[model samples]
Target chain A: MHPIGTVHYLVLSVALLLIGTFGVLTRRNIVVILMSIELILNAANINLIAFSRAVDNVNGQVFAIFVIAVAVAEAAVGLGILIALFRNKETVLADEVDLLKW
Target chain B: MSQFYTSTDHFVLLPAIMLAIFGCAVLLLDFLFPEPKQRKVLALLVLAGLFFSGIGLWRQYSFLTSQGISEITAFRGTLTVDSFALFFNGIFIAVAALVAIVSYRYLELEGEHRGEYYGLILLAQTGMYFLATGTDLVTLFVGLETMALSFYILVGFLRGDKRSNEAAIKYLLLGAFSSGFLIYGFSLLYGISGSTKLRDIGAAIVSRDLWDPLVFMGLTATTVGLLFKISAVPFHMWAPDAYEGAPTTVTAYLAVGSKAASLAFLMRMFLGPFWNMKEIWEPMLIVIAVASMTLGNLAAITQNNVKRLLAYSSVSHAGYMLLGLIAGNETGIKGMMVYILVYTFMTLGAFLVVVGLRRMDVIGDDVDDLSGLMYKSPGYAVLMLIFMLSLAGIPPTAGFIGKYFIFLSLIQTGHYVLAVIATLYVAVAIYYYFRIVRSMFIADLVDKAPLASSVGLRVGLYITGALTLAIGVYPEPFLRMAQVSFGR
Candidate 1:
């Protein structure tokens, strides 16, 4: 029955960021890695929306809209890339594409 | 009173909207005229549209100011028409136009489709235009991503090349990684400041607890996210690989477009939104600046591929631009502006020369590929020298003057130690740039070179080369323009 506040946004971001970090470190699937990025972006959106209310400024939501648009574009372009890469390499393991690593 | 005509009347947005329109037209044109010869013609038409828009915007600025037009508000405060955006827009569009011309032959030599590549180039330029004038963080973010999205596709343009695909993948992965960091920072800033509007955040910070450690941490984290995009030392690991792997044209785009957009955003984020907490960011910038230059320059010395070498060189140049940021004066900003003008020409010119040589099978970016470049193509060799010397900050080239002013601006702010380190790195940079020069002149030719002097490529090279020299010799006019544009 506890009401959420700024702290709730913080906690959500922390958890979201943690999940993203875990995905980045442990995942082999390229698509999942990209999905983790979405989680990270959503965490940002939560904070922005929370702050928009707290500060009483309209710019926050506007900025959030831009973030969503950018994220959608990113997801589209990124998945297209994954498709292209998969077509060529036949697998999605991050470790498999190690030929160019410095 | 009027609606349709004023729909695009937000003075700051004119160039950006024009660019987007141009992008759409380029796409449709490419679809209609998919043949190689037709594609070239369409590319020229798109370039003409971009050129007309660029000139129209530039001329409008002079006319408005001379007539003393007062407060012509178009978008109801979402934007403002100013000299700053106009100047940067010109630079972005001009660079894109030149890149499109060079890319015509670049794709053709690789036996790739010429149709949509130039369209994407125009689209990416549109993104940069938006990013520069973005008064709101929302606009800024949108502009940035539009630019980045276009690049993701362009980086992988060469379907036949493994290096191109790998580069695209790496660029996509790291790019997405940075976006996550950027959003996280944005959220953190919003959380503490209680606003996502950039100016609102500035206002909020003034009243709120400046000494609060949590708020400070949030802002710092946000900077880390943005700096990764700019490729400062720790965050710069992806640049070399991406530059080495992508096709040369995409690399040129990254070297110019990505870096320029990040710089414009950095200026806005710091000067517009976060200027209140100078103490927090000043030291952070100094550390990043010093680290970025030393690491980028020292790394460039060992690179074998010319593209990778320029990639590292660019990271070092980012350090110079950061130095201008740390100076945090009108002159510093002006210096950064002028430096961008010069850098766009020379850096892109360097890549163009590489594309030209690569087309001739003379050089595909191996340092040794340029062995006896002077013997086979004297004109290209000289053109390459112009670019290298400019990049090296040597005399009689735009690079030198640009560096001098940036360092001068910082020194005026009494950051003598930082200035000294920056100067020393400039010395180290000379060695690498001269290495390319030495290869062109000193190394013996390995094989009989195949060379063609296309009128378009030669004209493009001449224009950029002449600009580099002109900026070096008579920089006063450009400097004055930069000062006026940056409102000194």
Candidate 2:
């Protein structure tokens, strides 16, 4: 019940990052993997904003805005690639996209 | 507003701006000239863009030398114009030009010769420029994404091929995932420094406790991200697959151009911000370097696919360059730069031969596909031999010069164990590299088809092959350039 603090935001964002990393590693669906990447990106955005406020500096906030724009671009490219894969392979499952072997 | 900008800023940005303008022009002109025959002009336009960009880089170099300064900062220090950037830009432009030239015939063969392909190469080179020059976190992150996004699209340029599609998605997922790690680290760095500029962050880190958890976490995350970009071991799962599946021309470009840019970025970050905590990161990189060399060489021995073999070989090359950095001496840094330049030509030359083998029916990526290449095309077969010998770090080739400096640096730094281990891997590398040679000369022909030769392909091969030998024979000038670029 103490006033919200930077440490509190750090903990929350770290949790989101861990969850996103976990999702990306464990998920089979390429779409889910892409969403997990978004979560990780948002987690970074939250950290940037929180730290910006803590330091009374605006660069981190500006960085967060850039991060948001970049995240959108990344998602667009990821999905475009996804659609292409689907067109050729007829599956969005990561397991099925395995034409090239290790 | 007048005070906020200056001629220096415009001057520093001119090269990248030129690349961007040409990139867009290529894209727009493609729309006007939809015919495949006309699309060939786009390749020439890309070369022109690269040519002009090279001129811009030369102007920057002359300005620095004439002013008797090593570097000039622009956009209020967000961008830096320096020998280090100029050196790497030289590599990127050379790689892009070679790739563009060879791509014409390959794309025509694939029937996917579109304008966007050349456009993306220019745009990616533009991104690499920022990566080499950017001193701010915002600039670096955007630059990395620009380069990565273009490569992702290019990897999948063969829209009809499933392998290309799969390679693109894998590359995209892993690349985006790595970027996530990179930005999370950058956020922590900003928090710790209260600024997004790398110099500010470095200054702040100098004052902080070495073992601070935030410092440790930020360092680890950033290292992971950069390592992933360079395809270091444990984070290199996407490399072989991407290299094997990508259009041969794009694969060569990705292997050389992208790796060179990422190495520039890595050197900037480590030597700039995280340099103070060398005690922590040096050991970590040591482990990564050893693992990369050991695993990369060992894994390569079993590959029948020449593309995958070269892919693994590149992974090992990354390890050798890391050793140069870990030495952390002037010689070590100079050696790293020299190695990158040498590696570019040899690797591209090797791939150019493979590209020539891509007849209308032949994928030509298998080891057996190279059987009796000596008999089929003696010019290309001899060129491939020089490339392989160079790759194996034999004397009288540019690769030996690179490896020699790297090992000498390690020995000078008293990393005798690491140097010996790295040298041992060259033996392993030779085993695989000669496998290609054996196939080309000793093995019987599987297919007697003549290589799909064109003026552009032959020209590209000649440039790469000649440089590979020229640098090896008279490395003094190139070595001096590397030393100068290292600012010594």
Candidate 3:
């Protein structure tokens, strides 16, 4: 059996990031957009942990933990803001929250 | 050889640690006294914490300079204390202090006097300190996110208002997207170099003579994230809404504090680890600089909302600072530092004026709100005139001095065409900046109500107003400080 390699990990990471980005850009549901952002962040974690294994170093793994903590905090704040918006507007569609614009 | 840790290792983080502690103290104080009016006490407490942190930073700065130590790296290169970081630390601390002062009465009148506001501001300042000083990519990422997350909550602090909620959500969605891009870029950088420390990354790239598609992609993604934070054109869609909808004081803090912090991070990252790859990133920055100036000034001309107009003006000022990066030399960096310092004074002073006019009856954020302001308060009107003129880059103001340094640096670097274009936009900017002035002095009074004033707002105006004029008159000390900030 062939060994797992950096290339394989990077391919998977990039794929996840692209999918997440696509979802964020295309989706209108605020909840889905938040989830998409989480996916993008998890994609980064995958890259960090994979590169940590390949590089034989702990820095990337340490960074991955930090990333996870920050992602959770971001999600909490993002949801709080979303809830605030929903309370006032009664909907979470991105287009409806258009009280401010050019 | 392995290195041993010592007491000095912890000393380097003293300012940030102290600031974090102060933030927690504010939270505790708020828990004890949950009354809205008690928020003023919390604000004063935050100021005291800021004062102590400022003194700590000053002592560290003095110690380092006195010992002739140009750089001190601690926590195994994750953090570096140097004049560059110290300079930015001072700016961030000053901004936090000034914002606290200005927000006092503004929050009281808006009925949004929550203790979390001061706590979050202090927390955000700590994050900014780390972002400016972090020498490791991991530290930088954490710091940036810390600052950004605090801002997300702060922007929506006025949760009762529909516009504030809208601003918060829009800023969050866009900000999170950009952070994803930034993190992915950092991941790629780590993969390519196999290190997260900036010095080690520079060494690895130089040793391998590395250049590849991945590197370019990573750099581009990182630049995009930073440009968004600074509200540069093509990435400035969130700024105007965020600025206009946020509580006036938060908008000022967001405008001056966040931009300076991100640019400080950008300068460190680009000039340190990626200096070898300048050719790849420099052209992209130049294009961003040009687009930001043109689009920012042109769009600002049509804005009737004063906050939105200043938001656009902030974008254009970001463009001017980017020119310093384009110069890509020592003088350029010095000029960038001076430009940001002066920009902080003028922008904050201008925003504080907007906040000064705010009352329960009137939002006081519209251009028409300023009509006949001269008749109501001659002192504030004169102060606004000074800030407006400075912002227009007219002579005898710090804004002019800042622009002069940037253009001179550009000319020194043979960016003649860019300088010429920037000057033309400065002319365009004057037209818009003067629009408010004309309304204040010439137009009929829309509402003859006496302008509401406060002690906090007055102090803020005086400090920033004096600094703007003083720097313009005697720029030698600031210029010298900028020169010394190379942190060599």
Query: What lDDT is reached at residue A53 by model 3?
Result: 91
In terms of docking quality, how is candidate 1 classified? medium
Tell me how far the alpha carbon of residue B384 in candidate 2 is from the true structure, in angstroms, after superposition: 0.6
lDDT of 3 by residue, B186-291 (tens): 8878977889998887776666544677777777877888888889988999999999999999999999999999999988888887788887788888999999
**Tens digits of lDDT, candidate 1, B100-188:** 77666666677785667877887888778767766655666677788888888888887666667777877887787787777777776
Q: Output the better candidate (2/3) by TM-score.
A: 2
Error of 2 at B282 (Å): 0.7
Better of 1 and 2 by DockQ: 2
Provide the TM-score for each candidate, comma-separated.
0.94, 0.99, 0.98
Name the regions of candidate 3 deviating beyond 4 angstroms: B1-5
TM-score of candidate 1 on Cα atoms, chains taken together = 0.94
- Report the poorest 10 consecutive residues by lDDT, candidate 2 chain B: B1-10
Each candidate's number of clashing pairs is 0, 0, 0
What candidate 2 gets wrong by more than 4 Å, as runs, is none
For all candidates, state DockQ relative to the true structure.
0.65, 0.88, 0.86
